[model samples]
Every structure is written in C-alpha cells, then in structure tokens.
Target: MSHAAALTLPFDTDTILEGLKSWAACESPTFDAAAVNRMMDIAGRELALLGANIDRIPGRLGLGDCVRARFPHPSGETTAGILILAHLDTVHPIGTLEKLPIRVEGPLCYGPGICDMKGGTYIAVEAIRQLLRAKVATPLPITVLLTCDEEIGSPSTRDLIEAEAARARYVLVPEPARPDGGVVTGRYAIARFNLRATGKPSHAGSRLGEGRSAIREICRQTLAIEEMTTEDCTFSVGVIHGGQWVNCVATHCDAEALSMAKRQEDLDAGVAKMLGLRATGNDVSLEVKRGVTRPVWEPDAGVMALYDKARYIANAIGFDIAHQSSGGGSDGNFTGAMGVPTLDGLGVSGAKMHTLEEHIEIASLVPRARLIAGLLTTLGA
Candidate 1:
C-alpha cells in the first residue's frame, strides 16, 4: 500500500497555521539567548503535551539552550532510528514582528522565520502527531532536535548534532525546500576567518613615507584572496574595517572572510592558502583567526537510497520529486559527512529567505505536511 494512502493527518490545516503563527510571533534571533529560550519553551510545551520526553539542554559558549524531544519505539528497540533536525533561531532580530507581522494574505503567510524554518519545524511536529493519532506502531524510535544557534553556524551545538547523527539510522532536515521544489542531496563545505592587519600611523600628506598603512596592506591581501576563487572553491570578503580618518595612514585594518568549496580537498587547499598570507609591506603585520568549519555534504550511496525512498513517497502522493546540491551549508553537513543517510530541504516550499518578504505558500503547507507524514509512516513500517 502507498504510504500516503496508509497515513492521515490528525489535525487540520487551520491547526498547523495556528502553530506556525504562534512560533513566528516569538522572534527568536540566534544571538538573543532569552528570545530563543522563549521559543524553545513554547515548543517544549507542545511536544510535552504530545507525550514526548522533552529535554532543554542548556547552551554553552554564549548560545541559547536547545530542546530535544524523544518518541521512543513502543517495542523498546533502542538501536539507531530516525532523527529530525531543525533550528529555533533565525537571522531576524527582535521587534521585527512589528514590521513584518504574521499575517496571511491569500496563499502566503508573511512573517519572520516562517519560510526559513518555523513552518518546517512545525510540520515535523504535526507529522509525528498524525502517526500517533492513527495509533500506528513505529518500528523505530524518532528524535526531534531543535537547536538555537543554527543561523550562526551552530558553533555551540555542532558536537551535539554530530553525536545525535552518529546514533541515528537516518537524518532529515526540514530547512525550507529549494525554490524549484527539489530536496538537497549535497552541500558545499564552508569556512570562516577573520583577517587583521596592523601598522604604524602617520599623517597622510606630511609623513606619508614615515608610515606603512595597514589599510593598504589589507587591500592588497584582500585582492589576492579574491583572486583565489575558482569553479570548485570561492572566497568572499564580507566585512571590512579600517582607517578612522582619510587624511591619516591607518594603523589597523580588519576583514571577515568566508570561503566555500565543493570538495574537502579544495577547501583544505583554500584554507592553507588563506592562512599562508602575510604582510607585504615592511612595517605591517597580519593576523588570521579561524572561525567555524562546516564539512561538505557529498552525495553517497546512503543519500541516494534516502532520495529514492523520498521519490517513492512523493510519487505515491501523485507528484514527482527531484534532488539537487546546494552551495549553502546546514546541520545536514555534519550528519551527511559523518556517513549517515541524510535527506535535507524536506520542508515547506517558498522563496525569498532572510528578507522582509519571507513567506510560505499557503497552498503547499498541507500537502507537504502530508508528505512528511507519509515518509514517517513509511519509515516506521
């Protein structure tokens, strides 16, 4: 029997919309620990009500806490099972809800974090709810882990996420589906670094030769770094700061650099090149600090098997499914690289992420929920 034919949603569309609205109303920006904790509290309550064991794991390294919900197998089998990964935090700051209210207009619901992931997170919850209401016995345990620092590279939770993935039979990340309705099978490896240059300051006009400008040194190195971009690896210098006064030779300059690569070897080569850069000017010195390093999610045999199962589920619902690789990185990167079967981008369908126009297609909500429900049921079977 088809998974879709075997499953049914316990709640209606209105219930899911209400849940999303409640989540979107609470602005849980990644940097604000309190705000993110509030969002987690709300979700914790909902999951607790559903008879799942809820744990609010405290955050370390200046990040908000994470909430983990467990639906153990009735048969008490405790090997590895299904894992659902998501994030409660978004890029939007507090008070954003005032400008971008959670309102429904025709087929789209406008709000902060709705499309980026609030919608997706709730859909996962609803899928589990559907399975429970149908009294279907799950063959394996299910775990839902929602972290608070994913928007900021998951620095505090990377180890925890990897640990969970190590124990999971398969991982699913509902991070907003691609605009073309394709799921992500692979993702680029990413690295972040901070570059700083220091030198002596002097008057630009009167003592030009007496000083070596850090700004000039940094600019030269920046150009060299940008030139390192290739089809396999790319570099971006996003934030640059230098010189307080235009008439004075800058004593210090700094820049934030981000690099992405399609392969691990390319990323290693790019990192070595970036770290090898030194001050070309005589009086200037350079410093580089490494930031987060996200491994590439390369498609493997396990990933292909998960995609085939997803395609089968989609086809049972009367729609064709497609898979693609992305340049962006997610928690899936850690899991996929760890050799776990990971299927990402299995969330609500929408476009314009990380902007005021972020919204989800109202029409796509229920069907996608049904799809998730079907997948969960099929996996349990």
Candidate 2:
C-alpha cells in the first residue's frame, strides 16, 4: 500500500484499547522498580513482535529499567530519525486498580495511568504496527524509548533520554495532549529541593520547654515556602515526614518541595531563595538541598518549524491542533533545551491526571494514532 493510502486506513480501536488496558493493569508506579520493570517487559514484548531491535537497559539508583526499540527502514539506511518518547511509570500506586478499575463509560475510558501516558504510548506503538502491516515505508527509521522514571522528575533516565534524543532528528513525547487537542512546543523550568529541620527532643509530657519541636519548625517552613509563590515563580511542598511518637518531641523533619517558572532566570532566582531559607529559631537548624532540575524550553525557530509540521499533519488528519507553552516538564524539556526540534503532549486527550479520576477519551484513540503515523511517514522525508 502507498504511504498516503496507508495513512488513510483506520486503526482498530478495540485492539488498541486491549493493549492499553494490559499496560494500565500492570500498575507500574515510579517508586516500585519491580512493578515498572513488569510494565517495561510488556512494552518490550510488543516492540519485539514488530521486528524491532530491542535493548533493555537495567535500572539504576533503585529505579526500573528502560526499553529502546528501533524499527528498521526498508532501504537499510541507518541515520538519526524520529524518537517516540514515552514513560512506562505512572504516578498511581500498585493497588490503585482496585480504586480506579479500567472501564469504559460514555466517551471516556477510565483507569490508572490511562490519561497520564500509557494510552498515548500504546497508541504510538499501534500506529507503527498498522503501518508495518500495511507495508508502508517511512522516510526514516523510528525509535521508541520507554523509560521508568518520568513521574518523579526522571531522576534515573534523564541521561539516557538525552543520549537517545541527541541521535534523533526530532523528538515526540506522548505525555497526554493539551485540553484542546493541542501539542506542546515549550515547557516551563522546574526545580526540586529537599528540606530538613532539626530540633532538640524532649518528653512531651514533662520538660517540654527544653525541646524545640522540629514538626513546628517544618510547618512554619512549609507555609513560608508556599507563600513564596509569585507571578514569575511558584513553590509547593509535596512530601513531608516527621515524628515517631506522640509522647516525645520530634527531632527531625524532612520535606520535598518543587518550584516552577516560565524562564530559566526566574527559576534560578527561586532556587537561590529556597537555598537561602533560614530557621525561625536559633535552637533549631534548617538545611536545604537541591535535587533534579528540568530547564526551561522556549520554542526556538527550529522548534516552531517542527510545530508547523505537526500542525499541518493534524490539519490533514481532519483536526486542528494549537500550540502552547505548558507548565509541567517532560523529557522534551531536556531535548528542547538542547536546541532539538521537540514536540510534546502528543498523547491521548483527557483530564484528571495524577489522580484516581484519570481517564482518556475513547474517541481520541484512533485519530491521535493516525496523527502520529502521519508524522512517522512524513518526517525526515
């Protein structure tokens, strides 16, 4: 079949949904390396079935492994091609299926990780499958890199993502489409920080005056950190832990904070402010440590040209796609910052991400797949 004729062919929604459900049912949360590896195993099997050259990179820093699947070109030419970037890890925990079981209701398909990514990842795979079955030859090779650590700032896979992206001509991230079925051309800068507060411990029932409560100190710091939100930068404390016994004062408290900005300079200022934080009292001490960071990705000329191509493809597919600068960071941030033509948010359309109410539009599966397939055939031509 000709490439144009193959692009016009409709995908089997039921088959795509079946594959996605299998992925979502695996319950691969970011912190659970074993669970994430199981998710990778399923993806690797699918890619292998498509005659892809597969490489499974083992996990490091207690994280899950990553899978790289490269589809060969018909002409036997090997060069920098398209990189389909997605993540197998979801924010949902292992037992979350019991709460948000996979099901179809009206036009939406509900399940954990369905909207946040697995849906888009499966759709990308299906697009390639359909093209192969139709014998449509793409102009360039395609590589799909499914990592296991995107939900938590991609701590373990950032280097790998950059390495793969550097070799590819274009990078596409299926990270849930924008609300209006649009794609992301730029992303805000993001930084994570670890906070610790230390205080003197003492019996709660007696001699309480001698104790400096770390919990109280942490509470004050949390409020201060949150209050730092501004038009240019925003801060939020996501995780905190302290106190072991009710009868004793807490000696230490730890917290994780995140800051985001539209510009890198703003994020840098935010980082400096976070690092300069001081304790409210002399009896207790505060320590701030910076963690993984995703730099701001403003759309350059190359990025805008890439978006134009995606826009043309979407329009040809009978849909209009707008472009915008999003807040949340993805692996695209790394590639985009490196001056690569990166496009993101090319995933399924849905809402309620990172929550039990997450889902994807059932009607969005086929069209989005077609769009991806169109890009695959046209890019690098």
Candidate 3:
C-alpha cells in the first residue's frame, strides 16, 4: 500500500526551465503534418544532443514522422534499456506559439501545449541531459520515442509505439499527472463513433403523413441514444446535419462524435445497446459505425506497481503523492493495456489541454524534472 522514498541528484532548475523554453519554440500541431515534421526535427536534434541514436519512422496517415531514439548501454547487452515515450506534436497550432509564447508568470508558464506533452517532453529530455552529464550509466539502456500524432489518438504512430513498448522493461508517459503532482495509474478507454439515421423525405405541409421524416426519426434516435449514455461511458452528437429543404421532410440524417468509457464492459454495453435499437413505427433506418481506437488501460496490479514506485520515489523526495485514475486516455493506455507496467501523468501541470488556454505550472517544471530524474534512477536500479 506504500513505498520507500527515492534518491535524487543535483540539477539546476534554471537550466531545466531553459530546456522547456527550447521545446516551446517549435509549433508542433498534430493536425498539420508540416508543423509536425518541423517539431520532429527539433526533437531529433535535441535527443541526438542527449546521446540518443535517432531514427525517423514514417507515419500511418500523415506526412509527419515517428522519431525514435535509443541509448544502449556501453556493453551492448539486450537486458538494459527502458523506453521513454513522448510526442513531438502538441495539440496547438502553428500560430499558437506566436500568440501565446512560453511565459513564466508567478508559478505558471502560460503557453500552447505547455502541460499536455511539451512540458513533459522537456522533463524527459532533461532527465537524459542530467544522466549524460553525470556519466551515470544505468543497468538498463534507454529508448526515446517521439511521435508526431499523439493528440489525434496516435493513429499514425501506435504501431511504432507498441513495437518500442514491447522491448522496454519500463514505460513512462509525461502526460502531466495532475496539479498536485500525483501520477496516473489508469485512464479511461476511448471509443469514437459515426452514427447515421435515414428516412424518406416528402413535403412537410400536405404529404407529411405519406413521407418518412429522417430528421424527425434521427431526433428520436438521438434522444434515445442520449438516454443510453451513463457516467461510466459517455456519448454525444458532436456534429449533425440533416435536411435539404426547410419545408420538406428530411431524407437523411448523420452525426459524428466521440465516446469514452471508464471500463471495457460498460463501453461494450453502450455500443451494443446503441446498435441494437431499431427504427420505430415511422419506418426509419439506423446505421452506427463503432470505432474503438484506444483500449482501456486498467489499473491492474502491474500498473499499480509502477505507480507505487513513483509514489515511493515521491515519498523519498519529501513529497507524499498519490496515484489516481482519470477519464482521459494517454499513450500508457496501449502499453498498460498490453500488460506492460506503465505510468503516466509525469509531465507538467497547468490544465486546459486541447485548447489555447493550455499552459504549465512554472513551479512544477523543476519539481517534475526532478521527479522524472528520480523515476529514471529507480528504473535504472
């Protein structure tokens, strides 16, 4: 239920903050492949400087690249390396960096993608810096994976992530645990959906009785589906467009949305129920495409061990931190779901992800950097 405190080495807070600044200079937007590539170039250069052997792997659905780096023990033994996964692309756009640059005001660094992963990337990068500078070789080697499309559910880089994860003894995701600096032991699974309802269209005025209103039927299904949603799993109509003419009965109805589940069974139940519902007396058609890209990373015993390790380290460093589960999904979802001992929320904290309001707790920079350094030390031993 508890763990021993961890050990730490000396590192400069200023230098680490500078490292964060260097990362913020690039506008790594996941939606823009060009921007993603540019961010990859930046990550590659810094990782190379930190003594990692870097490579560029092509993406699945974008022009961006999955940049991977490895630092093997001098002995070249297969037994000694841990994989560090981070993403090069932030959720912010190209113009975001300009309008909202990294600024340390009070205890927060307000900027784009500051806490999501950019801040975490710097923590990982700096951990490498300290290790290299100290010439502290671990019993385990280290591999760093920086992807260009993490925000987009990592659709383009999941394969590479899984491949790298397969070889490592430990996996760390700097997803910015929480403002309190607690770690994430488990996160909800993600399921995206595209639902459509169809019906014949006719004049709304005279022939209303003869025509089947797709929009009306869709509204009914939407309400029915809305009631189907529960707190454990959620569904929504993010985008909906139906009807060609205002006076005419709508012929077609369509909607696209994202759904999430805290548990696998609940997710399945939600999806199954949504699909099973048939058209009502109006003779409407129903079609649902169920898509689950991210599996739920349950907080199983193995995952709990990693969080325990982090908690132990925090305690050792005079910080009593607790690990909690979240509704969000991270790269840890895949690795942990695959049965790897994984830990996430190791990045900076500032809240407001996927929005321009995203930022980092400036005060958390050095502490999180030290936290990561301490975590790596534990992994090495």
Candidate 4:
C-alpha cells in the first residue's frame, strides 16, 4: 500500500503545523539548559496527545528531560524494534525561535534549527502517530529517544543512546533530508579541541624586548594550522578571545577548534600540527590540550546490510532512495561508529541549518514522514 494509503491518521497537516508552531514558540537552545528543557516540555505535551507515555530522563547539564516515551503494541511485545533518534536541542539561543518563528515563505517553513533538527523531531512524532493509527505492531517494540544535548555532542546522553542502539536492530536519525532528498549512510567522525598559548608579560612599547607575546605565538601557530586544513579535511578556529590590554604585552591567547574528515590520519595529523607548534621565535609557554572526542562513522558491511533493508523500505514507498556521506557530525556518528545499522537525514528535506535561514519543506513532510514511519514499522519485524 502507498504510504498515504497506509497512514491511518490521514496525515493531519493542521496537527503537525500546530505542533511545529507551538514548538517553535519555545526556545530550545542547547547552550542554555533551561531553554532546551522548555522545548522538551512542549514536546512532551504534544507527544502525550498521541497516547504515548513520556518520562523525564535525568540530564547531566540541562533542565529539559531526555524523554523516553513508550508506545507498546497491544500484544505487549518489547523484544526489539527500530529506535528513533531525534535531538531536541538546537544551536540557536532562546529568542531565536519566537523572534524567528517558522513562517511559510513560499513552500518553506523557515525558522532556526528547523532544518538541522526541529523538522526531524516533527517527522519522528508524526511517523509514530501514523504507525500507531494504522495498527502496525512492529515485530520489535519501539522506543523514541529525544536527547536535549545533541547539538553540543551527546555528552551525558551518548551512553544512553549507545545502550539503546546496541539493543535495537536498527537506528534512524531524523536530521533533515538533503536538498535532493538523499539519505545519509555515512558521516565524518567529529573531534573538537581547544588550544591556548601563554607567554611572558612586558610592555609592548617600552619593554618590547622583555615581552614574549603569547598573542604573537598564537598568531604564528594559527597560520601553521591554516596550512593543515585541506580539501578533504575541515578544521576551523571557531573561537578566539584573549589579551589584557593594548599597551601591555599580552600574556595569554587561545583558540577553539571544530574538526572533521573521513580519515583518522587527517585528524591525527591536524592534531599533531597544533600540538607541535612550539613558541615561535618568542619566549612563550605554548600548551595544546588533547581533547579528541567522537569516533568516525564509516560505512561497513554490517551497516550496509541495514542500508539494504532501508533501500527496500524506500522501494516499498514507491521511491528508490539513495545514500550519501557527510563531513558534518551527529550522535548518529557515535552509533554508526559502533557498526549499527544507522540511517541519517531521515527527516524533512531542508537546509541552511545553524543559521537564521534554516527551514524545512512543507511538501516534504508527508513523504519523509511516510518513509520514517515505514522504516519503524518494517525494521526488525
């Protein structure tokens, strides 16, 4: 049967829109624990209406609950099923959502985090609703885990996510479909690191010879790091703040990095380059803290087996789905690295994430929701 035909809830557009509007009203900034919790509150209320039992999981750093809502089949079977993963945290701050609410600009639903994840969250809930209404009892039980810290690295919830994925036969991430509507089979493993350079303080003008400017040491190293970044690898000095005053020789300087690529060699080489950057001609104490986090998500035979199943699910939906790899990272990176059958970009087709122009397509909702619902209903059954 077609997804539209299989759907029992009639694809309630009003319901979805209302849910999105109500959700967008709340600011769910991952940077702010309170904000994320508020967004989770909105999610809980909406999920409750569908007869799902929602509970608050303890968060290490946030006020919002890492919700684990259960909707068991009447048969009471909880053996196994597809684990739907969608992060509730967004990169935007509290005011972005309300100040930048989702608007129908043409056929798009524009809002902060709408593309990167809020839309995926929408599809996750909507798909479950469709599946429940159709009375499709998954062969395995279904568990929907919405973590509040995905934007900042799973941190507290990553262990929980891995435990869940390890038990389930399949995992699906609704991180927003690609512009061409391609699903992601592989993602670059992400590693975030910070670097700081310290030096002697002396007058920049009078005692310039006595001063070992940490600022100068950092600047030279920045150039070396820039040289390390290549086409295949992406490394950025995303944050930089330092120095005491203009006249005095600045004693401190620092920079933060967000790094990624397909190969470990690339990441390691990049790290070595940063860590090996000694005090350039200056008398400075240069320090590089090794903070390599997150493993890579390469497509392996086992994950490929699961992709076959996903492709089959797509075929059943009157479409032939294709897979792609990405340099961006997600919790899916953690799971996928574990060799789970992880599929990403399973949400609505939208782009411009982490920016004010982010959006999800109104038209893509039904199709993507159908695809997600189908994956949930068919996998591991």
Question: Which prediction has more favorable lDDT, 2 or 3?
Answer: 2
Each candidate structure's TM-score, on Cα atoms with residue i matched to residue i, is 0.91, 0.98, 0.85, 0.89
Count of residue pairs whose backbone atoms collide, per candidate: 0, 0, 7, 2
lDDT of 4 by residue, 1-381 (tens): 233344434676656766776666666887787778877877877678777788888778544568877775554535555678889888888677556677887888888777778878887888877777776665666778889877767767888889888877778898887667878888876677678888889888889888887878778777777667787677777667779799988889987777777877777676666667676764687777766467778888877776777677667766776888876778888889887788988888877888888877787777677777766666654
Clashing residue pairs for model 4: 37-64, 80-140
Model 3 lDDT tens row, 228-257: 677788876666889888889887888765
After superposing candidate 4, which stretches have Cα over 4 Å from the reference?
1-9, 61-65, 74-78, 97-99, 202-212, 244-249, 315-318
lDDT of 3: 0.76
Strongest candidate by TM-score: 2
Weakest ten-residue segment in model 4 by summed lDDT: 1-10
lDDT of 1: 0.87
Which scores higher on TM-score, 3 or 4? 4
The stretch of ten residues in a row with the least summed lDDT in candidate 3 is 1-10
lDDT of 3 at 73: 74
The whole-model lDDT of each prediction reads 0.87, 0.91, 0.76, 0.76
Q: Which scores higher on lDDT, 1 or 3?
A: 1
Q: lDDT per residue, candidate 2, 131-190, as tens digits? A: 888778888889999999998999999999999988888998888999999999999999
